[model samples]
Target chain A: EDQVTQSPEALRLQEGESSSLNCSYTVSGLRGLFWYRQDPGKGPEFLFTLYSAGEEKEKERLKATLTKKESFLHITAPKPEDSATYLCAVQAVSRGYNKLIFGAGTRLAVHP
Target chain B: GAGVSQSPSNKVTEKGKDVELRCDPISGHTALYWYRQSLGQGLEFLIYFQGNSAPDKSGLPSDRFSAERTGGSVSTLTIQRTQQEDSAVYLCASSFGMQETQYFGPGTRLLVL
Candidate 1:
């Protein structure tokens, strides 16, 4: 079965501290890996999409890198505004035209 | 340029009642999707509409859940005989095509009392 798992369910960091969130997946064939940031009570906001291994994309302080079996979202010197649930999802080729399998997001809290 | 939009930002209904959620995708988008998200959980794919066709209804959890897209624009997701387990945020998303990046709307929060 195609599935995605995100680790470090919750993380608390002081302002300026940085960390990485993990998303591991097993799919029939990887079409794309996506990262999103969601604030409470709102839909996820698209962040980055990595289409292949060794692929990386960045926006603001978030950088996403993809591998054959997993993806990593690395946060650079974070701030309080960067505090939000980071979600990871994957689109499998077999399920290519249909849906996205999402991971239970990582709740990140950065305190100033 | 508006993104996707959903009706009834919040809905509260008694158990066994029926409810309808609506989604208006960005103009010209060819694909739309509906997803359910339980509190503090990941989003679950419910259904999707490509143009006027829905080739996959297998993502829907039960027969009680149904969706339709009209004129290749707006979409509606209806839940019949709502149960407490049906309480969740129903989110709508759209993309230029089935394989493109999806843009989501602020979800409708549904509460089954």
Candidate 2:
């Protein structure tokens, strides 16, 4: 079974559109939840990390929130450049030092 | 100071050939990692390096896969007699310490044809 699952495998939106991507995880012990943005032909870039439920972080048009069982990445008034695959990962406590289990990311396309 | 940097951004080699990918982490970082991402697939942890201690090679898929870190900075992941299944984007990242946020480099995309 997939440890992590992301919904809406692909999404297309017009410029200034707002939407949210969901990431659900089932792990032995969730040490942290991470959100990343990846561009074509490039490595994934870190965006935020939430450790506890009800925790949230924001940067520009991107905001990530975490619950006990899932996490949400909300993009508000997104621009065309915001188009990219958004990845969610979990750091299991049993796995130490930079080891991460990632989900098949959501491919987001923003049209102008 | 610059972020993590990887070399040979793209490589295409015949099956059974050897390939080497390099990663130079930011100055003063103590943790380094390697991950593989196939097309339409999520990232797969390959290895981890922390300080000068023995590396965590548990994530390595096979004996043909191995990596090394020198001076606790730059790292190299080598695939011996690579198979078609080894083709993927190999990503490297460095962090200040264990459990810290990691900064990634633009990965090396390897295609074993």
* Candidate with maximal TM-score: 1
Candidate 2 lDDT over residue span B7-107, tens digit each: 99999999999999999998999999899998878988889999755457888999999899989998999999999999999999989988888888999
Q: lDDT per model, in order? A: 0.93, 0.91
Native-to-model Cα distance after best TM-score fit, residue A46 in candidate 2, in Å: 1.2
lDDT (tens digit, per residue) of candidate 1 on A3-103 = 99999999999999989999999999899999989998888999999999999998888899999999999998999999999999998888865699999
Error of 1 at A64 (Å): 0.6
Please report, as a residue range, the 10-residue window in candidate 2 chain B with the lowest summed lDDT: B50-59
* TM-score of each model, in listed order: 0.98, 0.96
lDDT of 1 at A40: 89
DockQ for every prediction shown: 0.80, 0.81
List the TM values for chain B, per candidate: 0.98, 0.96
